[model samples]
Target: MFLASSAKPIDDNLKNFVDEIEAQSPSLSVLAARQFRYSLRQTPVELNIKEPRQFNVLEEFIIRAAIEFQPPPTEDELASVLGLDSVFIKTTTATLRSLQTLSATSPITVTPEGRSFYEKGSVPQPPYPIQINAITDPLSDKITFQSESLNETMINLPDLADFITIDKTIADIASLPLEEIQKSIQASGLALHIPEEGKIVASCKVVASTQKIWRKISLFVIFDALEDKLSIQIRNGKQILESASNWLEVLHSESRISLQALCKLSTEAINFEREAILKQKNTEIEARIEKIRKEALETSTKANNEIDKSKVLGEAVQLRNGQISLAFSEVLNSAKSQILIYSPWVNQAVVNEKFITLLQKLANRGVWILFGHGIARRQEDEDKPVPPEVEKKIRAIKTPDGLPSVQFFWLGDSHVKEVIVDKEIYLCGSHNWLSYRGDYLPRGESVYKVTIPHQVQEAYEFLANRFQNHAQKLWENALENRDFQMAVESLCVRGALGMEDIALKEIQNNNWLELLPVWLNVALQGLKSKNLPGDSESFKTALSLLSQVSIEETFIEQLQQGWRKVIGAIAINNPETALNLLSDEVWAQFIRLKIVQESDSPNDFILYRI
Candidate 1:
């Protein structure tokens, strides 16, 4: 006798309402009872109705209202069509709106869904037949259900909504197991109240359960969607259970619900949430990478600059007065065996104390030291003697042989000033070693270390030979006239007349008196041995000077005495034999007494003596 049937389980309250109606109508026909039962199962029923009416007013109103109003009727118009007062119409429409049977904003037309509900002869198919879709908001602890039943009922279950804790994309939700999802929803405190039914369903079935770890915390959850409700289960690992559910009865009566809309909304929200999260993470990562790149580039640039500076230093070095001391120290310290210094003027005040100390140390180590200064008269208009302190320091230098370790010389004509170290390095420019005082000098000066090998060697050789010649000149100038006269007489006694003739001529001509002693020493040396100190430039120079002098009568007796010895030695065919015949030392006395006569040139002979 039933007009319609469904496999869906009916709520107890709905079944009880039908039972009460059947019990109250004892005279109701079987057909009427069957139709009423079917109606109750598929469509919402008015619990206040005590008996069946000839026409179902609610269904008729919905159908007729939809047909009459293209742009649905106003409340007044709708009331007129139904023959009801405006207040009654308003109240009925509100209920219809709540069920989604009518538009909430209106001309009072029936909803498309509402039309579908009543088209099946007041015995609509089971509502919300499609699967339920749900979304969760973890931060707000809310869950939103997208289902035809939920939308149709306009049920705002704040308690159940509050349970959703996380907002996720459709993909994320789909990928997550239903059990874990249920646990998350339950943890948010899911609960729903059915105000019309005066009932509350706080528990949900977990069709599936799952455990997952997120951010280092274990999460156990259950997720399921039953015919009448969408449910979730949440647990903190093994304890602290929580659950939530959205019941179908709370949203729509057994007869009316829609699943398509719910799925669409849920999918949209999920995609939006996922995109937003991924974009944020990507931006943060990119920013961090940019910062690191900048720092690395800055560091690399700094390193390159330092390397370039080092290269510059290796190629060449420039030094001024302030930096010259350090440069000098490096030059001196690098010396292994030789040090040569040349300065135009010599004075204690001009030389650095540290330089003097270093020189002394080098001298003690047997490193050859040559210190040159301009000739006293050639240095300036006024002659300057080597400072007393400088001489004392020089004299203090000790060597392995107990001989003077440092040789001092005068650069008579050359004005070059430079320092040479071990023939490997050299410094040249305007830096005056003997006169520079970095603090007192107003003029800027520079000294540079020579890097070219040939240049260093060339400079070293020039200075060395010049210093050697100057040293020789100094030693020769220290000899006295008697020293020279004795040297000449020694040669005469040896009957080396050829050499004596050369010496006599040197003494008479070119005022070679200063070098007479050196010449006589060489001649004496020749008489003592078969070979002289070989023919040196110095000996050749002496001979050249003698060639330029004219013989003078002032030395006739001395010359004749020397000539007689030479003649005797040669006649005997043995100079040593003749010299032995003259009784070795006697001729030196005559030559000293006779040859030491007054010179015609007072200027040349003023200090001369025999």
Candidate 2:
């Protein structure tokens, strides 16, 4: 509804033009009044008239302005000439341009069609004529008409004059009921037969001219009385055209039919039929496209499934740090029943927080987890203890059953790093199974994953058996060792007094050095035992007290080295082997350091300094 206007400023003459239109037509007075107000403010006016009659009035005003202006007018000049609002003039010009009645450039001029319609007072001409033939058999109840030139073309008109016994009835045709006339004709003996109820039969030979060539067409005209419409069907041809019933009514008048109106109606009918056919074709094309798309999608899905299957069964793939981590997580998440992981190194930093949470979730869903790491083979390896953080995380998992869903085992001889999920998928390689720091170091690793059921089952069984055998051997050796058995029993005593008695008895008997290995073995066992709360604080305190003793630098080095060896053995979660590495002298000094007589409580034994 926005108005556009010429850049020219408003003048006094524009105000006079507004007064003239306001006095001329009431239908245009509102626009004139709006223009007068805009002229006072020297601003462009806005017009929003929507009624058809109002548009006709506005069109007439524009035509008058076009005639008055000599060299085409600016929007303001035209508005001034017509006494219309500048905004109304702008809107009218824009609409005329869209209709191609006015040119679309500055200094707007009327188009040729506009000149004909407005300046010359011309009207739209039709494309063809409506023909009528004289009536025959006038005296009969059923009146018939035959074309003057074509005898076969006939129209069986209703005999209203005969039924009513009236004379000169054509003048009163409007008063007569066409339905009653139809009934009288149907009852008459001379009534021409029609195959359908609504159709009236007629035929004519039409000559259609294109360029200079004229083609003869034999066509039938059928009137549908129910719908009040007429259809022209070409004889022995598929093309059918329809027109309004008003065309036939014109023929019933004393005047000749308006052939121009009839031709326009015929063109409209043909255009409608073309549109329907186009719509049907579009629908068919869309359905075919949808079918093709669905087929393509189904084919693509099948091909992708085949590719995935091949990848799972193919040879091992080399992977970088990120790739290996992704592969491990993918395999772990896919586990349905159980997962077995074997790696020599395990740490909270390496295993990462995400993997830990994944383990927790899997355990909540009843998936069993078994982890194994290699036992320390050298004293230097002892520095790698089972990270206390990892143990705390494991303890935090609240499963349905009171027992932990995860189990840890130490591998004495094996160094293999692998992951097995559900006993069906196996991932084996140089990649560390538990700990992988992505892109932090230039480490090259690769792992192969296969779904070969036999190899997977064999690998799973071998690892499980190796862990079981190691645990059995450790248990048997612990039972055979008398000193180890006594140390474990003494460490199990709960009270301060019992700790004092054990510490004093060992130092007095001069067997405290033998007690050192046993005590470390018991501490490691406590860490790994599901039911035992790891007494790390006590072990740390005992070590600190032993350090306070007046031992030589070499002895101190041995003690520190022994401590690491025990921690490394425990890192692999093997307490029994860690105990075997401890010496008798180390254990003796450990007890002697805690035998201060000045200590008031048994727990105070650990608080004593040298």
Ten-residue region with minimum lDDT total, candidate 1? 32-41
lDDT of 2 by residue, 1-610 (tens): 1111121122333444434433432112111111111000011111111111123667666655665667877789877866778999889777766655577885767776555556434322221222322222211212222222222322243222222222322312223354533343344432232213212222222232111111222223323221223443321122221221233343424334331232222434434433433243224434433443353344346566765674465323345555776788799998765677878777776666776788788766656576767545432455465676776675455333333456554543234576878767777766776655544454676565655565566666666544444333443454457445434333322110113233424433443444454344333333333222233345444454464445443344444444543445343544443343333543455445422232233233222210
lDDT of 1 by residue, 268-294 (tens): 433443343324323443443344335
lDDT of 2: 0.44
List TM-scores for all candidates, in order. Answer: 0.27, 0.27
| Candidate 2, run of 10 with poorest lDDT | 32-41
What is model 2's C-alpha RMSD? 41.7
